[model samples]
Target: MRNRHAKDITCTILLAALAVSAATAATAQDGMGDDDGLAATDLDLSGTDLSAIDLSGTDLGGATRLKPIVVEARKFEEPIREVPFSVDALPAEEIEAARIRNTADLVGRVPNFNFADTGLSFANTLNIRGIGSSSALISPSVNYYVDGVPLPARVFDQRFMDVRSIEVLKGPQGTLFGLNSQAGAVVVATQDAVPEFGGEIGVEVGSHGERKLDASVGGAISDRVSARLSGTLYGFDGDIRNIVFDGAGNVVRDDKSVREQYSGAISAKVAAELSDGTDAVLSLRHSRSRERPTTGVWLDDPHFPRNAFAPVPETTTETTGGSLEITHDLGFATLTSLTGISHYELDLEADLLDGFIGGAQTGLPPFAFGAAGANVRRIDETSSQVSQELRLNGEIGDRGQWVAGVSGLYSDLESTTDITSLAMANGAYTGRLKKTNLAAFGEVTVPVGERLRIIGGARYTYERQQFGGTYAGRPGGAPGLAAFAESQESTFGFVTGRAGLSFDLGPELTVYGTIARGEKPGGYLFFNQFASIGIPLTEFKSSGTWSYEAGLKGSPLADWLEMSTAVFLNDTSDEQLFTFNPVAGRFDVQNADTRSYGWELTMTARPTESWHFGAAASLLHAEITSGNALIKGNDVPYAPGFTTSLFAEYRHPLEIARRAGSAFGRAEYQHVGSRQIDPANSRRLDAYNLVNLRAGWESDSFDVYGFVENVFDEGYTTSAYRAGNAAGGGGVFAGIPGSGRALGLGARVRF
Candidate 1:
């Protein structure tokens, strides 16, 4: 690992920045106005010492000024600081300024968050607040929603287009979000068409064939209707190099494993005001990606990975979804209905050793392989989900608010797998899973006095799951060989809820405490190496978690300085975990008990109109309290103990062709603590630091920007595991490397 002194120094500097902001706010100019009662839009920036600078609009498509972050952290629009939850909300400006293009782009930007990129989109892993699983098959601990439509895991890491805002709410939210929200929730809101006609287009090209094009158009269809259409086409060429080896263990050729990558997504939304107090919106979206991806690096090298597979691996994924939302406002309350439907499919073709990836078995002659000594494997999967929710929310006598809702969801997933080699241990595999859920939930907040308030909520859920699978045994003269099939069904009922209290310390500050319970559904794994022997595919049980949290949130220095800090503890029961049972010679996903506690802080400030800076950090300790002896007391895999990010941007007013313009420069620094990758604490990846730099010249009509990602070219691992034994037979540790440094330039035009 690199020296740690730099990270410590940066952290100290970030802390100092916060302190300086506080000091500056205390003695701000008389007209600066540190009044907390002032709305965000009412903030007075006139007192700043920028009277000599020409500060019009910072830019055409972006800005450096801080805006009040509004989010649906509780499924409704509200200022972030006003919400009692531990959450981080990013407005459209922040999203674009930070260059967050997709879901995976949020990893280090948020505290206590990490991601493991597994080459394939659907197979990647995500951990938030130290609560998540390394196995992609397990039910998600966190929930993801777009425009109020819940998204399944297969399509959860979606591309962002026309996004208005994004919010990351920590801790259990089962009372309102229901299943798959044991850890937290990620909510995204896209832009809605306005009454005026407007559109924008952007293009970028960079090193390694990195290219992107995005466009959005919106207009008013009628006095009561508006519509928007947005689309993005972007991709990059191979970033990881692969070295091909011959049968004699000699390198024959070198080439990139992933190449010719391309992807595109489009979304359309139509909104109409049906009546005096009723409104409706219809949204539809589709996305597709195709690429020949690398087989993943076997060693720790970030630039080169050895492989013998001649054709590498190919994968294609597609998703289509639609949502319908209707709302009617009564005299004192509002009623809403949301219906969502989506379908996802995947096709993968790869060269493997024993149903998985590895080059060690290439020299072995007994196993069936291609002419070049590589087993051909193929997988095809499809899944569909539909959900409907009806909710009613209203205020109580101007002091309290309440919401109640009921929702139901149904999903079906099916997949088929086959190896070209018929004599392989498993000739073919097929599986199908169906799930049903019905839930009702409600929450109410009542003021106890001028300074105190009480909160309570609950959700009752009924869940049913059915799973069936078949495995075709090895072909040929093997006696008593036949395809095996099995089916199982189960049902469960549970209640989850939250209770909390909020107290106003003053007009500028507030304190809150909350306790919440959340749950995750149980299911069966689709693929296993022991399937031929009929090991029943190991059915994991459902899990639950309890969270206790306390936080302070407010605009300490009015809109100039915004901050939130929280400490939380969580206890989980029957937490699903995937482990290799060497004794049993098969993989097992059993329940385990675990504990996690952490502190999170996020802040943003603008001491002067030209300067905008922010920092986010988290300290965490998560470990297995009770589990298999091999993992007892061990840190959870891939969960970083500490993570932090600091960003500062400077914008100088510019004159371009007699139009409003600005010159912007930004610097971002991120540090991720070391992470454990296995159950026994035997494998730990080193911590790493990254810095990104961006500069641009923006005008009312056009903007051009340049950026350097991973400016330091840091060498790090994206994911790791005990590869050989975990996958097939060649037993050794392996890893996939993170991306290397890259530079790019982009241009955007808007009217």
Candidate 2:
């Protein structure tokens, strides 16, 4: 392995050298620096004096810009310091260059935000302020959105392309964004089409036989219309292998698994300046993605020694959606209306237990009777949703601004399961579900004084749900129990609100305090005949208290440094808890109370024109406050007590090689604290940290780079499955090990 890695690196360096030697005559600017046309002057902000200028009202997007401005938490468009909560904003350029594959990678670097992969290629989970569920089939306490349009919770296969920026709003955001925000919200904004003609293409290859290609184009279709198109192509041979037998009963499924993904979107924008001072814009966006198979494999096994490379059956998922939005600037503020529709299909199958069930089994009765064999379990499902929202924003007085809105949504879902029950014939079941929701909300912020501002808002929401199903257990011992379920509906309503105060302590310091109430809707679950025939399960619901607080947003010691820190307390009631009943073979939801408190600190520094450093650290304490009889005050499932990340980058002028653009190097360290699989806290995962290194040279139109992940080749487990153990597996079946130290190289070009 060592020799192979060394050869790969050597080949990469040789190729890079040849490319540089062939194209060394062009003067270039990568556009990340200042556009003043001054060589290396873009980095001059470090030593410049700012005391003489009033930078209070300057639009950072234009002056010391990053990219498109984001207003996810705060309604205003000033610096992030003005908001009274923890927030992390990363733009497209940084995301692309850093090779952040998904939302998990992005939040893994931020304080107080933990995104955990579920081992499924498409579905992911998040933990914020120690408040998130670890279950793969339940709705998340956190809310997610794209372009101001809220998405259905737990729809994990959604992909992001042509994204302009991602804003993570920490803390409860129930006032404006009700239901599903008891923890927080993530907003994704995509780039819009412009009147000018421009486009870019990027391609990369990396570790684990990974390869990716992306392209985007935007321009005007006519004088009053404009359109933009973008597409992504991705393929990778997964690191894990399946070592199971094939149809020929041959020992196959070694690291031979592969995945392919494709996604595309088209956006259209229309505008016409009216006779008045008001202008309007109508925009539409549509996107879809098809994934070959999302497979999860165990890292180790006893029965199947080579099971790590087994060939699991193939599965697929498809996602398609469209959105329409219209906005008019009426001088004082803006009036916006948005409508969206989405549809998804999932065709997945897997052997829940990694080991073979029947044929040649040693101590299994089913195997003795030839009642069961290596059969696949299938979960086939489809869902559709539609939503509409109308909002108005404007200023009330010289010191006050307000926003009011209303929204409605409807959803329908159907799921079918076909299990080749080794004891019987192909048994199947079908389930159906429908849901509707309506909400109204309003918010206002007022400047109480020159140095203080007050904010408050409220929202009222109602939701309803219905379910029906039928199991193919007919003619069996259970009898013909036709699921002629009648209409069963329930209405859930809540008023969520927020209040906060912000004070400007000094020229470079600000402090704030806030209290808010967050809420989540209730919904039913569907199951097959294997589940007990008893009373219906309780719908899940959770409510919580969010107290956010203090710290500074600007450099307190020097103009070249900026820092922010905060402390928070989250007291949650009616916490949704899920428990499995072995006798019933089903999971039920109930209400409990929990308390979580934490602190976060982050720092960004640029000491010289060639160096930049940033670091963040977080600590959390979470436990169940009530329902001791049930959970026994266990720590939350996915919440880690401590996590930290540190990163540094340096750029140097290649005087020896005369490289038009400076060469750069980066290094990062990430540490995650211990976590437990069950609320009992009986089982725990040890703490571990990972190191990564990257170095590259980029020019005006092209870039070549190399990266090494898991530099120390540390091995650790991310998540464990209970189904494997239930099936009589001796070794705990864990999925997706943190890959070992691996190296790869890639290049990109844009025009």
Candidate 3:
């Protein structure tokens, strides 16, 4: 059945490609001049009054072209269509219309991107081409950056505000972005301070008691300085229910997995122009969020599909950071420097066992109490990072462009965990981890001819990791095992590189191919208390991947139509795999050999001035080529076999409104294929479809909009876990369900 579906999709894509080619060829053949193609005409409009002519609704037939988008995810600026990799650029207007708030909102919009909500904000995960970090302590395979400053994985869930653009770069980016970018990168650019004084404010109301407020203000403070500030606040009530009863036989009405939450962020930036053609920008931001974390519900229990027995599950996060960026231009080269520091903290408490013990103890005496039956877990963690980078960029005559840079990073992290029950206790576990990284990288691009170019880059990195921690037994346990402290350190280094060739077929077409190698450093896994006892924990070895890709991109019909397609094969060795250890009741990291091959297609068309359309699809086949028996032939977790999306928008002039305005509507459809949840491939999530609708009216100074998400109210799971002995004597399957249907209304005003 899967084969049949795959064949059908392949055939459809080929047919679409042929049709587009035919149309382009026909349009090219229909020339409007003589056979010699040297026809010319003279116009006598010297006495014509151009101001009296109305051109508001004129059909220019693709004469007025759309501006080309530039991408900066490669640490350099290049036109998106000419880049030798898969990239997606989303402008601010598109983000607003799509109602994108966080990483979770980006899935399906970009090819091969997926997100899983693990109930806790800090535990949520993102996957690109089946590569992601499963443990919170480990760096993500896909890195995220905001205005050139790297962000921690835990903060990926924060709400976006005053964003100017977002660029998604797929495949390995190690040569330019360094480690932790083995899979890809996401770059977010925010609005900068301008010399003009202006501001905007918006308010939104939605179902489930949702409310949001966002605003931004910016202006010039003096001839040499300009400043800007932006902020956002959002909150909503959850929809899940808790039906379990307490020990007093009274019904517990407190809703579980409720979204009752409040989160806000404020960012300020100041730019100064100094003498000697130099400039500097200082930025500061702070954010705080508190929410009732989602709780997992038993998959076998049909009576409470959206309900959980957990009584107390909550999480709170706080982040503060600042950065200073300076730039100077020399006669032959430009120099840039960036320095930044940030601190992040998270506190979470959840009922791990839920009601497993309560239900099992129904038929037994109430005397059973000890560490062996604990049902609750609480965690607190904090981390701080400081980073610095300096770079020089220049052009070699007229045929080449080059860049070289050096970067350094230092980070410190601390965490504490407590597990206990009413009558039993598992002593607290405390740990501290520190790391330092240094790197130097260089890249150059040279034109071989008028239509061909060659590009190459490489980076060398060195890292050192130090860990110290202690594990303690219950208060009444043996004195020898009551408490112990241990420390360990390790150092490693590696080099990664990329090489590519690109050719311009015409003014509107580009073809490119690239070969790149990406690497990610290894670190110790301290979650396993038993493994940390008596000796230093062994660090997992680093992992690497060699990727080969070929792609074609072009606007054959100019602004009327655009298309891009790419195929890639990635061979990975010592692939990092995260697995649950039932015996240890924790997660552990291991190494495996794997392979991933995939193809992606993206298209956009604006056949008419008032109508626009877009479509993107991805097909992947990723598996463990050689590994342990449990994973050797299994599919990579979280990677679907295929995914696709389609969207259309239309706008029309509104002549009956209070002032000059336009009305627009949009509809989007997305499909996500079935996916596995573990290396063993014993659990799978079924395929799901979603549809969204949005409509709005806008003018120069004001706008109003309404939207409906999950129009059909489909039910599905975003994440799942299987508990063997941890859930008592029998195994239990639990999962976090996806959000249900919702509607929202909003308005915005600008001055």
What do the candidate models score in CA lDDT, each in turn?
Answer: 0.76, 0.62, 0.74
For residues 1-751, could you state the per-residue lDDT of candidate 2 as single tens digits? Answer: 5643653454355345423422321112233245433333222232111111111121222222111123546544545666667777666755664567666577666777876666564356676887766554556778778777776664643556788767778888877776578788887778876778878887778777777777887777777666677777776665544444444445443453534345555554555444354444555555554443324434444432222212254456665666777667777778777887777777766653344332222333221322124355677888898988888888756756788999988988887876654434355666777878899999888887777878888989887877676655433323333333333566778888888877777655567788888877656555443421423445566455555555455445443445778888988787666555445556566566778898888765543355555678889988877764546588876688999876666677563345477688887767788876555454566777777788988776677789998776766666544333323434343444556677888777767
Which residue segments of model 3 deviate by more than 4 Å? 1-59, 62-64, 254-257, 356-374, 397-399, 422-425, 476-480, 529-536, 581-586, 725-731
Identify the leading candidate in terms of lDDT: 1
Predicted candidate 3 versus true structure: per-residue lDDT over 475-552, tens digit per residue: 532233566677889897999888998898876678899998888888876454552244445578888889898998
Q: What TM-score, to 2 decimals, does candidate 3 have? A: 0.89
As for candidate 3, its clashing pairs are 238-259
Question: What TM value does model 1 have?
Answer: 0.91
Question: Which 10 residues in a row give candidate 1 its minimum summed lDDT?
Answer: 46-55
Which has the better TM-score: candidate 1, or candidate 2? 1
Q: Which sections of candidate 2 miss by over 4 Å?
A: 1-70, 121-123, 157-159, 246-253, 258-313, 356-374, 396-399, 423-426, 474-487, 528-536, 545-548, 582-585, 628-630, 655-659, 724-733
Better of 1 and 3 by lDDT: 1
**Model 1: per-residue Cα lDDT over 128-233, one tens digit each:** 7778766887778887899988998866876788998777778888999986888888888899877789999999998789999999999999999999999999
lDDT of 1 at 585: 68
For candidate 2, report its TM-score. Answer: 0.83
Considering summed lDDT, which 10 consecutive residues are worst modelled in model 3? 45-54
Best by TM-score: 1
